[model samples]
Target: MTIGEAYLRIAEDRFRRVKGLGDGTFRQLSERDFYERTSQHGNSIAIIVQHLSGNMVSRWTDVMTSDGEKSFRNRDQEFEPADLPMDLILEQWEKGWETLFNALRNLTEEDLLKTIYIRSEGHMVLEAIERQMAHYAYHVGQIVYLGKEIKGGRWESLSIPKGSSDQYAEEMKRIHGKNGG
Candidate 1:
């Protein structure tokens, strides 16, 4: 019911969105394919997962009490291409997010204003959560886009399909009704 709780909900929703992307489409690609760099500027899915895990672990552990960036976080290594297997990537993803959500689940509404540190700088608890949500969303967008490119026309739209905005709006209006506004 608090803003942090709302963030947890969004995290859960988007985490599922990230995982769902790999469900069917990933199986079509071999390790070599999954590891394949789709663009000169972008990392493969494996590296993105590594970064996500690193960020989650660093930012969530002892979040309200300690610097979010831990002493052991190897920040530089996150960007390096990793020969990580799909199973390992999936494991890290699961573990990282689990730790984050578990921590969030334990937070009280009063705790929202408590300060946390990241990179030795101060952040309000809600601010840090919002920051990471934005970061996760940025990467999820990349993942979806890259996944679609890799799958070509065989890929499904991760969101509303082309030219279907009106249909979606109409359905929402019918269900919720204009007077509900």
Candidate 2:
């Protein structure tokens, strides 16, 4: 594959991994868990989902032609308490990811080099993609952390269990011909 193709593949894989972490966390959470906050100053998973969905729709829609921070997006409102149903909250989360994936699907290698505007500042398409990836990963980490806190000892491991690194490595080596990381 070409460099651009490789980059896109890796980027997509990384984004999927991040999303999978959130997905796994969600499976272990109750509907009320979505609304729970670690502290009064912290955001709930619901609010994070809302913010992410709003950001994805705004940034990915008309990605190349329009500024990422769309005029229609209410950044402040996304942080407010989302008293919506679990289904609706999940729908918004899926919608955001779908928007992002759709936009990524439509991109070409050449487009990576082209400049895009985010809040009126110029960023190459590749830079913009990385920026969003980091941003989403940050929020997903919060979701996972909160989920773990809520579930405590009952929380299932999204990755290998804490004390199983050696076993995991052996398993990986067995599967990947002893060359696995």
Q: Give candidate 1's error at residue 35 in angstroms.
A: 1.2
> Once superposed on the true structure, which residue ranges of model 1 sit more than 4 Å away at CA?
1-30, 178-181
lDDT by residue (1-181, candidate 1, tens digit) is 8676776667567656655664544555566656778779779977887888898998889888889889989977988898677888878878888888788778766777878889888888778777887888787667667677777877767667889999988888899896656
Give per-residue CA lDDT, model 2, range 106-173, as digits (tens): 89899999999999999999999999999999999999999999999999999999999999988888
Whole-model lDDT, model 2: 0.94
- Per candidate, the number of residue pairs that clash is 0, 0
Give every collision pair in model 1. Answer: none
On the 0 to 100 scale, the lDDT of residue 99 in model 2 is 90
Q: Model 1 TM-score? A: 0.82
User: Which 10 consecutive positions of candidate 2 have the poorest summed lDDT?
Assistant: 172-181
**Which candidate achieves the best TM-score against the true structure?**
2
lDDT of model number 1: 0.77
